[model samples]
Target: MRLIIAEKHSVGQAIAQAVGGHMEKHDGYVQVGDDLVTWAQGHLVDLAAPDEYKDHDWDRWSLDTLPIDPTPDWQWKVSRDKGADRQYKVVAGLMRRGDVDMLVDACDPDREGEAIFRRIVKHAGVSKPMRRLWVASLEEDAIRDALASMKDETEYQGLADSAMIRAKADWLIGMNASRAYSLVYNARFTVGRVQTPTLAMIVDRDRQIAGHVARPYWKVVAPMGGWKLAGERLDKREDAETLLRIVNSDDFAFSIFKAERKQQHDAPPRLYDLTGLQKDMSRLHGLTAARTLSALQSLYEKKLATYPRTDSQYITHDDLDTLRGLTEGDRLAAGFIEPDAKPERPHLELTVNDAKVAGHTAILPTMQADKAALDELGDDERLVLTRVVRRMWEAVGDDYVHDVTNVVANIDPHWCEKHPDEGRLLPEGECRFTSRSDQPVSLGWHAIEHAAPQEDHGEEDEAAGNIIPANLAAGVSIAPVPHGGATLSEGKTKPPKPFTEATLLAAMEHASRWVEDKDLKAALDDDESHSGGIGTPATRADVIEKLIRTGYVERKGKQLRSTEQGRSLIDVVAPKLKDVAVF
Candidate 1:
């Protein structure tokens, strides 16, 4: 008999259903025709704590036990999380079953999933022939297909090695640095490889906002008949007045030196990876990353969505047919699409890039979503499901088309040279003004976005020049209007906005942008898995939550700011410890 171990109970249940047997359910496991299926509650086994090592007295948090390196002699312990130990025993017992000859690692298809299965096997001291069950969806067909074409567990040894190395590295850094800092400061301080750098980013941004100095400037705004022309910025009010006067003067001759309009097409957005979904949820729904993840996880278990922890934003060519099916029929009408809504012919291939999709495809609504009573889902789940479903249609929708017009007018050189303030405020050359406008021809994919509910960020309106007259032709003479012409608009340069959850997630995902060392930045860029980031899409939200839980970062409304303690921690940590490139 073969034993299949899954990452969670729901996954194991789904696998058992796909396996198709009598399905005799037991405590912590299920009995299929000729196989046993079980699960681990997250990490059933973890790194042994420092105090657990018999070779050292590291239990007493002291500076002497500074570098807690359990190198070649690393130890493992069962997790104390509720029910983890019990579940581990059940899985271990099944592994040693007399009839079982082979084991299947049916964990989530990712690096962390590999680590979870390996740790459980090692801690249980079981060495049976193993196979890997890798699938992105929990749907019956997907699971059965993955089961029939399993690969030898040894084929994934390299992935397992990398996972182990990352776990140990995190342990070493977190244990030693957290203890050393806590001892010196006489307080409990928790440090992590990725979490520290993440905190540093927040602290740095806060400092920038606190120390920022605003500068004032002025611009000349002239109201044409149906358009507005903006002049170059001037440092002094006198200079602005001189240019404003030149444009408004009776002798001033206004003529369009250039006017051009070009058609542009904006492609639809790519599908959501986990981080992208979390970011959008945080922005539009005011949901935290953890909350978004939890809701998605629930949806995945219910077989309404595909995998929720993936980082890839693309679907493989193999999923093209599935994508096509989703766009047709009543699949999206469950709760998101209106009956009268006429979606465009979806360009299904737009999001298909096999090379970009790694272990799993981007999150998609399962066909089951169509039959599910989505209204019964929790508010958060419904909100996320709606977003996912809407994005499904939008991802394959038509491109947005718009006509952009740019116009530039030059002030007659004779008038500039003849002005009273000739060489003073006015430059030697001809004074020029510019205008731009965009006329959207097709809403396209944006139509779907517009149909969904959006959070009012209270964003300011577009500049006046964004809608100038399209009829203005090159070399056309113009006369300035009476009121609101030649207006001197004073503005102040604003400081950087505080980090919202959405922006912070973006920063963490693209951490290489924060690195100064070229070599290190290049290395990060070349990393295929992380793609120049400190944490995976799976762990970043947790890191942020940990910082908040520890009182290091505080959330004021939607903005995240480092508290006094958080800033002080960043200040005290050594440069190497907080460096983004190093981690």
Candidate 2:
């Protein structure tokens, strides 16, 4: 008999179905064939809190307990999750059974996933033969594939080590800093590896906004028939007024300046990764990051989409055939017609780059998805899945096309005779104009539309327009218009916007920028060796939520802001921990 331990109940059930195990209800597991399918509801055990140690001095918060480093003899406590204690006992009982030959840690394929299994097994004192059942998706096919190709547990020792380091570092920081700050300021505060840096980003942005100052400037405008020409005045408003007086002399003659036209292309957008999907859902549908993730996970469970919690924007070469099948006969493939002679080779390159991927491939649609099944999903879930399917089709489809044009003019000084003080220089019919056209071109992947009003912009402007009008050589001239009005507008500089979950996630992923060692920062991004970065995708969201719950950070609309207590805690920490280094 083999005991398969899963990260959660849903995952265990999926694995059991894949392995063709019979259903027998035990206290905390479902028996199938010779396998005992059981799961941990996240984590069955966590480090004991200070007060749980039964020390009166540690019962109340104090700065004196500055750095509470737990020794090997430190106690472990059962997790507070509703049914964890019972679940742990069930797992232990299975491990102790004489017939069980080996144990399988079938958790999510990430660092935290390793931590979940290791903690449970360590606490249960099970030393049986062990292996890892690493599957990127919860789909039965994916699970079966993983089981058939199971790797030895030792293969992931580095991952386990990294996971342990992250957990201990977080424990050290969160326990010590939280207690220290809460005691000093008489407020509840929490800090950790990911959350503290995140809070610092928000506080800094707030300070930048508070300190910003505004200045005034002016510009000059000339109108010619249907077109308008504008130029900035020197820094002083008086200089602009003086120029207006000179140009109003009625003897000034305008000369042809310059005209140029250039062709431009806007490629279609890249496929969605977890962060990209979250940002799009938030911007388009007003869904929170947590809600978007939940919907995506549901889509994956139903076998309609690939893995959801991924950072990679590229797929493996092995997935090409599956991708090709999705693009054939799909509703999203409607407008694309395969070439008659040799279907133009699909542009699989954009989604197939091997070097940039980490952990798993980009979020995509599985070939098994049925369009009719969409009716069974809730409104938001259906919307998000539809987006995923559409993106997959677009990624492999043709590029978008566009053409551009530019026009320029020169005006006579006599045009400004009536407005000496206003800087209005062009008369009704005294301006020369020129026009030119550049060739039309394709924008590649950026042309594929992801949502309705296909050309809509996202919050961060990842693919904002950069089209330049066609150029007409410097001396070209055309018909001119007689008169136009000129006016100056005034505005002040604004502060940086607060961190949204989307922006904050990006900051955390790039947190190594704050480190000083180039080598350490490089190592942080070395996915093949380390676990990508400081926190795994499965744990980052929880880290963020913990920060909010502990009052170290607060949400203002969609933006995150650091509270007063959070700011003071950073000041109290040693400079090495707080400073932004290259590592």
Candidate 3:
């Protein structure tokens, strides 16, 4: 008999159903044929509290208990989360069952999932033969396939070690620093290895926005027959007027110095990892990372999508056939997908990389979703599912092809001579103007993006400029229209925008750029999964939510601003704690 342990009750039920038998439901487990399935409500067993350590007075929030290092002799306890204790007992009871000769670790396929199962087994003090059931989707077929091809649990020991080290490091930093800082300030202050650096970034950006000073500048633009050319930005209005007068004159003619056209192809974007999905949802629908994650989890449980917590943006070689089917038929039947929009010559290879897909495949819609009624899903779930479906089709799309034309010209010599003072102000006695435009050769992947125009929020249309004439080539001279005189446009430099969840998520993902040390930055960037970020995709949302929950950060509409308390914490935090690399 086998005992299958899942990460949650919904997942447990899915596994039980996939096991194929009349399931006998119990208090917290289900008996299916000769096998039993159980679950943990997240981390049912976690590191013990500081006070639980008998050797230290770590319970008292004092500076003396500054560093809570519980290494080598670390203790474990049942999580205080609701019903965690009861669930632990149920799982432990099953592990001790005499008939259950084999154990199956069927938790979510990730580092945290590995840690969850290991902690429980160790806490229960039971030795049994163990196997791992790793599946990316909760669909019945996928689950059954996983059950039939289980691997020995020992294969994932490296992943478990990494998870444990990360957990302990977080615990030591959070416990020690939070207590030390809170005791020093006489107020409750929570600090974390990842959360502190993330908070520091917000606080720094807020400071930058607050301290910004806008500078004014002017530019001269001349209208040609079909297109407009712009002069360089001038620091002084008088300098701009010099160029303006030269272009406004009827005698003004352009000597085309350089005109070049080249064809360019924009490759389609890769598939959505969890972070990428969260960022897009925040940008497109104004959904929080936590909300997007929650919706994705629901979709995963419904077997409409694959696992939700993956960091990889590509699938393995084994998943290519499944991906091909997803690209065809109604597998991705979200209402947002246009009926005519199909990948006739899908580039499935663009989304395949065996080495990159460490555990779970990229977030994808399952075949089961093709027949499921999507409208029956909750509002957020439906919205999230729509995005996932759209992205799947978009990932395999052809390249967007376009021809870009760049032209640079100089005002006629006669005009410069007509206004000698203005000519002298110009660089090398010539006023230069430049214009660029892109003409679409093929819409390709852009067709999908264009079909769902509402999905793009902040993206600027590259092809929105005027059409450049084919005859306007190098060495050609054209007179400026007498009707449209050159004019000076004045504008002020805009301050950087505040951090929205989308931009903030991006900043967190590429945080290696913030580090000054070359070696440290390289070290951070070396890990493909992290991509130089402080936290994993699985933990980043929780870190953001924790910051908000603790009143360190506040959401003002879509913008995330560091609160007064948050800034204060950053201000008082030890310099090393605020460093991204130090974490």
Best-fitting candidate, scored by lDDT:
3
Who is ahead in lDDT, 1 or 2?
1
TM-score of each: 0.94, 0.82, 0.95
Worst 10 residues of 2 by lDDT: 334-343
Please, what are the lDDT tens digits per residue for candidate 3 over residues 1-583?
9999999999999999988979899999999999999999999999998999988888887776667787789999999999999999999999999999999999989999999999999999999999999998998889999999999999999989999989898898888888888988998999999999999999999999999998888888777766777777677888787667767766667788889989999999889999999998998889999999999999999888999998888998889999988776655644656666666788999999988877778899877675355878888888898888888888898888999998888875666677777667768533677788888998887776564435332412323465888877898878766544777878777667889999888888888878999987887777464554778889889999999999999999999999999999999999899898787
Q: Candidate 3 vs. truth: CA RMSD? A: 2.2
List candidate 3 stretches off by more than 4 Å. Answer: 331-334, 417-421, 428-430, 451-463, 526-532
| 2 against 3, candidate with superior lDDT | 3
lDDT of 2: 0.66
Residue 526 CA displacement from its true place in model 3, Å: 4.1
lDDT of 1 by residue, 128-149 (tens): 8999999888899989999999
Clashes of each: 0, 35, 0
Provide the RMSD of all predictions against the true structure, rounded to 1 decimal. 2.3, 5.5, 2.2
Cand. 1 TM to true fold:
0.94
